[model samples]
Target chain A: MEISTTKQFDLHRRMVRIRLFEEAAGRLAEANRLPGFLHLYVGEEAVASGVCGALNDDDHITSTHRGHGHLVAKGGDFNRMMAELMGKATGYCKGKGGSMHISDTSLGMLGANGIVGAGSPIAVGAAFANRYRGRGQVAVAFFGDGSTNIGAFHEAANMACALHLPIVFACENNEYGEFTPRHKTMAITDIVDRAAGYGMPGVIVDGMDVIAVHEAAVEAVERARQGGGPSLIEAKTYRYYNHHGIQNLGLKYRPDEEVATWKQRDPIFTFEDRMIENGVATREKVDEIWAELRQDIETAIQFADDSPYPTPDQIMVDVYTKSSTTIGTKS
Target chain B: MTRTASIVGMIVNPNAGKDIRRLVTPATHTSDVTKVGIVRRAIVAAFESGASKVLLMPDNHRLAERASDRIKGDIEVLDMPLSGSRFDTIAAAHVFCQAQVGAVIALGGDGTSRDVAIGWPDAPLIAISTGTNNVFPSAIDGTSAGAAAAFVASGAVCLSVVARRSKKVVVKIDDRDKSLDDLALVDLAFINSMFVGARAVRDPHTVHAVISCVATPASTGLSSIAGRIHPVGRWETGGVFVRLGAGGRKVRVPLAPGSFTTMEIAEVRRLGEGEKISLSGKTVLAFDGERDLPVSAFGTVTAHIEATGPLLIDVEQTLVLAAQALMFDETARHISEGNHVY
Candidate 1:
């Protein structure tokens, strides 16, 4: 009941950064200024912002293909991320990894994955490493609804719960897997139900409500840090754009009314209203925050645009490591 | 070119039974799977009993939405942003009120009902027991509940005749000119606590006073603390006030689900109709078994008894009224003899 304005403002800042940064990427992609297909994190910004807010700087996380939000929330530098997405040398992976393979080892962000369910196992591995180090840190696996049906998710969940690992499996059930509806792909509506099969506590939260997701993540993170074993969190969310691009592909698979219904509960907009009502921020402050983020995102884009691309002669260099440059510093 | 038919509003609280009480007490977790089955049965019965449309409250778990697949009638999920709290319940009830719904069936415990009452105090409500606290709702099967709901909804049984007017405790808290008014269908406790954490009032030691709309020993909860000594009926004119502390008659009261504590009652008094009482508090107010709001230090918190609760549908009574009112005739007799009515 005691609403913390500071915590709320921090959460708002993180979400706005992701939204503005992704919107910038979207604008570039729409104008053909950016290359490659992007799985944008447009609607489901609350999941990343909420989960990463509850985590420590050293706490690890493995993100899915739609992962710009995760990286930005986890203290990722926007200039480096935009540069990487733009395939510049100043990018996170020196431009080779591009959008999907961005990672920050020092910040404990494992990587934004290209594969559907690949992050689960990596998060499990990170948790195992954290356990081996005897550190009280936790690792989170961020995946989508369709990813839960994969063999990797079940195997990782079983292993984590069995080993009492400090990990949280955060499922962003956005009702779609690429083009197909989730109901057509899976029988169970709630992906968290599978957590019980793996002998872990499953929590379902409204991913549109950042506070709900944040509270759930905080509880799960605390439980994992206290050696209470892994827990699964399923966030009921939605993606505003198409699965692969920013363009309107005119997909007939989704109902028009459902889209309108979800847009009514736009996380950022509703959260702004909630913040104002709860005395966390004023309308003026909300406007100021958005303006600031827009400016920040523009600067990052400029930084990426001015940077150099990967040179042809240096293709063999930094591709492999030890056979490579040292990790977590400029290559 | 179309006739407007009656609509039944169904509010299924997915977060109801699953709370911190599951950790503190051996409270039964109402799984989403169970909720789905209940909603399916309820929707089926409501349709079978002549309800035309049903509007479901949106939740993280698609209990009603999933159940809609099997329902062979008009169904729509209310278009609103879900906050995943009691605010969702209140908002849905408010929508249902504006729409002038024929009936509203809410699935949760007393807190769920309290939320609905706050939104629309006179809503024709059928509260089914699904969560931890058990004051407002009853253990009615989904089939019977759905049928009864439709009976009221479709004018097969009139709400004014079948549904009873329940008493409620009105709470008004004024702090720095911002006034918030809330209602409890059962008991409102002034708890000696700091914050409203976990929502449920589990610790009996932290409780100081209770004002009840219906106090019966059979109705298990904080109300029973007053109920065991001085009983009050659901259709009663007024409420009961009980001061909690030591040095009085100790009664074993069921506080939370699967947990009961011996509460020593210091004083008990009967409140008259529209009788207002002041609770001087730097305390947390637990309404209908959940810690709702915190009273600031030396804030003005006053409560009064009113007959402004929901139009509670007595499920069996509705069915019995239906049977006596010519429903147990040739159609029913034919169905009873294992033949189709139509």
Candidate 2:
């Protein structure tokens, strides 16, 4: 999975965009400007950036509550997302879906679901659709390690295997599923082990390393698109912020030392250093990208501010496809 | 107006709504999975909306018996020949079709609806949510669901105008052998792209389905994936394999066991009114959720989509209209005369 110049640069830009977007959104959420529950994807940027980078526009991806990173990584407009978080009229869901439920079907990014392990079966269904039509498209479902234990996850995995649907079940094992340590909550250490029961390949990747994740995801996506069966990839990543709101320190859960230990392998710094070490990019270029991201974040903020609030009538819309305007856009 | 009136029959799956057993004996309730409560509510609502008679699908499950007891008006309990198996639901549906019921009101998830639909094609169908994976059932309340059914039964709701007709895929195995009713309604799944199976439950094998409408135009199920990429499903009706978990170099399709996790499809074909699906493999064919006959490796199957169908009425609307009619303080003729009201 050697990175081509175009792919590498695209990954770099997307990683930066996700990080910056979260940082901006985190600030607004802290200031109480943004409404509802906000789960920042500050540290897990590489995972989404890398995995989504391998997907084609026709490929499908389902997201979790902490889905802003996936949304940005999959080419969703930052302005509309920001507007949605701000409850503006121009948001992807017309302000109905905020931080947790952002969606853009045109981008093959299904809305982030609030339920755990909910997207797994849906992605399988989407993959089934692709295979049935003889299309080379694939579907990906991104969820947390905590979701592995849910019946939905097991059911979906088994179905995926039995059906041989083209799908990649990407589990971002962020250690804590809302304060509970991964070890204490479950008997299985590796979420990938669950994949064995379903009789599929389950690969573990360093979620902190963007290149590693990209390589692994690329294979899975290609296999899916080429009529191969589904695969489950468990990306071991860490979240910098608390489960919700501003980053809560410990909050009576994880130890300070454990947090510090994981922080030592910060994905962002590692990527930046790797870029320089490989002579692919310089510190100057990195700084320039950061500057550009800052400008983009500012523009998104303006868009959200200028965006209108959805009229009350809009609320009556979008609940069903009979009323949805985007129904006919699918191929 | 009398010519427009359609006689719609209603049936309920006893394993719908919240899992009440989860509160106490999590094992018992969660084990078999029942939608009886949802079925009961939908039936009651339908009866309240002037449904002359409703059919309650029988099962050994206490939920079905209890639900059957709850309906308001005169009701008929159709005893399914299958002792206590899940096939009882399908048998009950067949009975309703044999009764020449103009339409079918199905209460359950996609599986239940699929079962009833296969048994009674072009029969007006009103599906209400009561099962776990509910893509076909309407989320509307039981009262509304029953009302909609009543209106359809009484010839108030128009099929071509209000109800959207769904396409069914006809599948055949070999040159001449077994067959499938509608292969695309989550009926057939190709596991790991190798083995063919049924159902959409948990498994490692990939799923393959042949669909009539895939391009976001039909039901959002396993077939939607193919619709997005190839869009071939929109042009024709057939099965496509949606692969799931990774497997050998071969194109493996994941399928459910008996019904929930895998399906093996020997042949793929289109479905219409006159077309039939044939299977050639020694594989078993499960229609909807009920187990059907087995097809040998050389069996054949065929399917054809029936365009002209009965008008499906919404139970909800039917219930609402019935309530309104009751409030009119007059007879049926009086309500009919009041139709001129602005």
Fnat of candidates, each listed: 0.02, 0.00
lDDT of 2 by residue, A224-312 (tens): 77766777787878887788758644486866776686788787787777567556789999899899889989999999999889998
Q: Against the true two-chain complex, what DockQ does each candidate achieve?
A: 0.08, 0.01
TM-score (chain B only), all candidates: 0.92, 0.62
Q: Give per-residue lDDT, candidate 1, residue B190.
A: 91
Candidate 1's C-alpha runs over 4 A off are A1-3, A252-264, A269-292, A318-331, B1-27, B39-106, B111-126, B132-134, B140-165, B170-183, B187-272, B277-303, B308-342
lDDT of 1 by residue, A167-205 (tens): 999999999998898878876767766777777777666
State the fraction of real interface contacts model 1 keeps. 0.02
lDDT of 2 at A74: 95
> Using Cα atoms with residue i matched to residue i, what is each candidate's TM-score against the true structure?
0.72, 0.49
Winning candidate number (TM-score): 1
Candidate 1 deviation (Cα RMSD): 7.3
Model 2, span B55-155: residue lDDT tens: 66665444545666744566676655543334666677677777765457776666666667556656678776654433345566655665566555555
